[model samples]
Target: MCDFTVAVFRPDDDRLEDAVELLESLGATPVPDPMLAVEPTGASPRDDADYTILTSKTGAELVAGAYPGTDSDGVADGGARTDRWNPGEATLCAVGPKTADALRERGYDPEIVPQEYTSSGLVAALEDRVDGARVEVARSDHGSPVLLEGLEAAGAYVHETVLYRLVRPEGSGDSTELAAAGGLDVACFTSSLTVTNWLEAADERGVRDAALEGLSNATVGVIGEPTGETAVAAGIDVDLVASEATFETLATETVELAAPTYYE
Candidate 1:
């Protein structure tokens, strides 16, 4: 166990209990906080779509959640029903293992999960195939434009639907308390929205500068490269970028960075 406390930005989700257990596994006190609130909207499969793209686990959940009989784990209800469209008939692409797992639980097999867990990675891996294909991307309103732009550049017709909206919750990060308590040991970031929302929350609490200063002193861990880039662009010094853009990897790397002799 290291001498640092691990702070996480986990939005209100069903997996929060698992997250807490994960944080505790690293032998540190966990301060799990929600920087953004996720609200899933009504979104479903399209019959005319040639392929399906899911960028996050939330998007996968939303797609399955829209249909009757499909629960969060994709379990069939007593009289679960699906649309006339067959998800199995369409090519499924997920950004990472967690996202793919979500789809798999819904009985949809993902054919494309990039070696790198990111939009650019997905594009790079499927660039040669997306040309002349019609891709249906289910994502949040805060999703990156990179996927859509890259697919369009590859001459693929894209039909994107917003499956969720991310809103900043009432209270933000406790930078004041953290800074006053000798700063944090690690700060976990899940997405670009998490970073933006944290900054906004801090600013709203009139502690943006103090928050940034505290973060600059702590190790910043990002789920993916784009998120790390977002944090850096926002004047937040970054320390760890997960090799795999998954929560498990993020937690592992955060704990590693917090080792007693990590910076020594």
Candidate 2:
């Protein structure tokens, strides 16, 4: 195993577990610090919109769980539950492949997935298609404003449903201590909220300055440019931005940057 340690701040779920396994496979010690938690609102997307968008895999799963015939893997066994909001004639869209996959698993076909996974990318993909259309966006409460504003500017009537809320988990921030102590070798931040919540965690622990100092000595990587900007705005130096906005690519590239010889 390499001597480097990589801190991953994902939600406390399969994403975090998958990150830990991926890091261990790459020979870097994984610091499994969950900075986010999901709170479902029990509100589903509107069925009557001309276009419906889902921004996260968690949102897809939460909505899918409400359906009857959508199996865990998305194979339809019986039929979609009548009690839930069916897509009807709405064209479904996902912000990225992962979210699209989640939707597919739940028996919904995502007709549009932008090459770029950001909110701006979604707007760019749909700007021409959604003019004068009613669009419903379902995702977390922390979704980017760029999506709503861009859609509205393109002549689409946009309504957003907060499928879930992302909050800092009660007992997170162990990685802040490790980072503050200069024990971290690399850190992978997946979103702007992750970056903000992490610093907030550091402040809550009274180690904000120390954590920033420690991260200076470690390689920092984010999933996209927005997240990178957030880190920079928070006085954190980001050494890498994954070419793709996915955790697998982010962790792999961050590991390679931290220990070039480790993978070889």
Give the winner by TM-score: 2
lDDT of 1 by residue, 39-92 (tens): 655556564767788887767765666433356544334433322235656788
Worst 10 residues of 2 by lDDT: 75-84
Q: What is the lDDT of residue 27 in candidate 2?
A: 88
lDDT of 2 by residue, 9-128 (tens): 888778888999999998889999998887666677898999999999888887776432345544333442223358889999999999999888878899999989989999999999
> TM per model?
0.86, 0.91
State residue 168's C-alpha deviation in candidate 2, in Å.
0.2
How many clashes does the backbone of model 1 have? 1
Instruction: In angstroms, give how far residue 48 of model 2 lies from its true place.
Output: 0.5
For each candidate, how many residue pairs have backbone atoms clashing (under 3 Å)? 1, 1
List per-prediction Cα lDDT, in the order shown: 0.76, 0.88
